[model samples]
Target: MTVLFSNSRNAQRYRAAFFLSLPALIGLFLFHYWPIADTVRLSFTDYKVFTGEFTFTGLKNYDLALKDPLLLLSLKNTAVFFLIKVPLQMALGLMLAMLVAKPGRDSTLLRTLVLFPAVTSMVVASIVWGMMFHSDIGIVNSLLESLGLPQQGFLRDKHQALPVLAAITIWKDVGLSMIFYLAGLLAIPGEYYEAARIDGAGRWQLFRNITLPLLNRTHVFVLVTSTIAAFKIFVPVEVLTDGGPSNATRVIVHYIFHLAFRFNRFSYATALSVILAVLLIAISVFQLRITRDEDDD
Candidate 1:
């Protein structure tokens, strides 16, 4: 009788779990997977919004995307943005996380304040940053004037625009990354630190030997996701700068939008998007492999 009742309970639990997950599975199929499949199908054809018709083009879109000079320039810009921004953001985030994760008074308030920007909408943040970075009569220039420095165009100049956008991206995203690292730091066992202290481990030794090894997984996660986010940055460029000053700040996604909406090159834009998707997948897979190997070591 006992064994029979146990089997009945197990079956009921399984049924409940299936029912609970059914809504999410259906939503994913309807939303994400369906749209992706449609995009892939459209990419192979001559699809335009105005015409409302699509015909097979047999890799013509991909061929055109590869040949486009704007697409190539956008790809280079995105690569440079990612390479410069991700490492700097991750370093700043890790430092902030360490500072706030310590067992001390006021830590909670500090952490909450740090995370405020991350929760704000990207469009709103971009607008605010745009105002702050205005070329003439802006707050930044006003301050520079008071300090006897020349007024500089933060977002209007070709040379300064990309770096300004990169700086804004880092400021807005670093808080969330800090929160992630903070949580990872908190979850680390106190016993490790205790053991290290007993062995007369200095602060540098504690971080190098104990903290880093355990935080390896978080480091990998932050680096991969932040790199991908830097590549996909569109809102700041679109709202704050609009890839301004002769395309100096034109990232890949902005270029893709221009191709699809502005130029009516839907199929070519899809091809560029497909390339970006593949690149992100390759990076994610490489990171996973590296993390697995490190774990084994």
Candidate 2:
């Protein structure tokens, strides 16, 4: 009789929970899953630009993508951008988090300053940074001249353009990363540090062993999100360079956008989108698996 009553209560609670979450579930299907399914479907169909028709072409788009030189170049550039942005962003974010982890007025001010750029519009930020890095009239060049250094063709130089874009984005996005790290830092118990000090553990030892190890989940979450953000780098490239200076910063998303909108090759662009989605999923799964394994060990 008791078991039956318990089961009945559990079922009622589940039904209540489901009813509460029903709207979100419906939104998830309509907005996220439905678009994903349509994108996948479109990937296999060839869209006629002029006629507004989609004819099923099976795997032809995928096969052509394999032989596309521009796609390969974009992928390589995107990888380079990722390498530059993710490492610096992670390091700088962690440093900032550590700096402001303690509760104080100074920490509060510092947090506000750090997050200022994040709240600022990305387009406005991109434009302002682009002007600042201008070779001739920018403040950066003016300072360089005053210091007896040559002006750099920042956004205009093919080799430097991608890195400049990465730097701009890192500045804009690092605040969010810092917040994640700050949360991780605060969640760490004070007792851990006290015990470490009791055992003759120095600051470096505590950070290396206790702090780092305990923040493993935070690291995984931040890393995965940052990696995806890095991979989808687009706005800075679009607003500032538009993949100029010999296509130095022609990252994947920008390329796909140009293909669909500029060139009107919608089908091929959808195929690239599918590829990007799969790549992101695989990378995220791999990161989670690695973190889980480390936890197990």
Candidate 3:
């Protein structure tokens, strides 16, 4: 009788644990893993909405994506966007976190204002920025004219469009990055700072030696995530410029969307998406490995 009861209790515990994890497991399969697997499978076939049928095209889609000039241009544009946005966002986030780490006069108000952008919807933010960047009648141009500076088209000019888009992205997203940095800062032990102070370490020396070293994980997280976000950027470009001013601001995601919906190139678009996913995964793995080595030491 005792043995039977013990076995029943163990079985009940195992079932309870499984039930507890069911929701998250379902979410992972439904939202993330399953969608990725579906996309991978779709990449090999000529799947389209109107046709309602698909035929395996093997690696033809990938070959077309590779040979396409616009795809190559989109890749270059994405690289440039990542290079400009990620560092700026990280630096701005770190600065905001440091400034708001300890409340001083008006700090609460400052924090509220800074975080407002992040809470706003991205579509709304893009629309507002679009209006602001309007060449002839926009607020930005008006201010430039008032100051007697050159009144140039922010989005209409091919050379200027990507940078303006990057700036908007940084403004809208930096608040979230700031919050992450703040959380990281809070996780750090105060004893480290106190010890450094006792050792006559200045602000710069303490930040350089302790804060940066301790925040390695946060740095890696921010870099990898921000880079991925930059690479996947689509809405702002789509809404503000429609991949134009001569496709100057066209990134890979924008191209993929156009290929799938506008050009009816479903297979090619899926192939491009798979390539992007692979690139992001490779980058994340490399970053994790490097950070793990640093942590081990």
Off by over 4 Å in 3: 1-32, 293-297
Query: Which of the numbered candidates is closest to the native, going by highest lDDT?
Result: 2
Global Cα RMSD, each model: 2.7, 3.0, 2.7
Candidate 2 Cα deviation (angstroms), residue 268: 0.7
Over the stretch 1-297, how does candidate 3's per-residue lDDT look in tens digits? 566678879889889999999999999999999999989988999876786888898998898877899989999999999889999999999998988888676767777888898889889999999899999779999999999999997999999999999999999999888888988998999999999899999999999999888888789889888988998999999899988988898899999999889998887798999999898899889878887898899
Query: What lDDT score belongs to each candidate, Candidate 1 first?
Result: 0.87, 0.94, 0.90
Candidate 1 segments exceeding 4 Å error = 1-22
Instruction: State the lDDT of candidate 1 residue by residue for 1-297, as single tens digits.
Output: 566678879889899999999999999999999988887888899986787888899798888887888888888888888877998998889899999987666877888887888989989888887888898757888899999999998899988888888888898999988988888898899999999999999999999998888888789989889988998999999897788789998989999898889999887788788888998899889978988898998
Instruction: Go through the candidates in order and give the clash count of each.
Output: 0, 0, 0
TM-score of each: 0.89, 0.91, 0.89
Error of 2 at 70 (Å): 0.8
In terms of lDDT, model 1 sits at 0.87
Candidate 2: tens digits of C-alpha lDDT, residues 1-297:
556668779889899999999999999999999998999999999999889899999999999999999999999999999999998998899999999998899999999999999999999889999999999889999999999998899999999999999999999999999999999999999999999899999999999989889988888988999999999999888998998889899999999999999999999999999999999899899989988999999
Off by over 4 Å in 2: 1-26
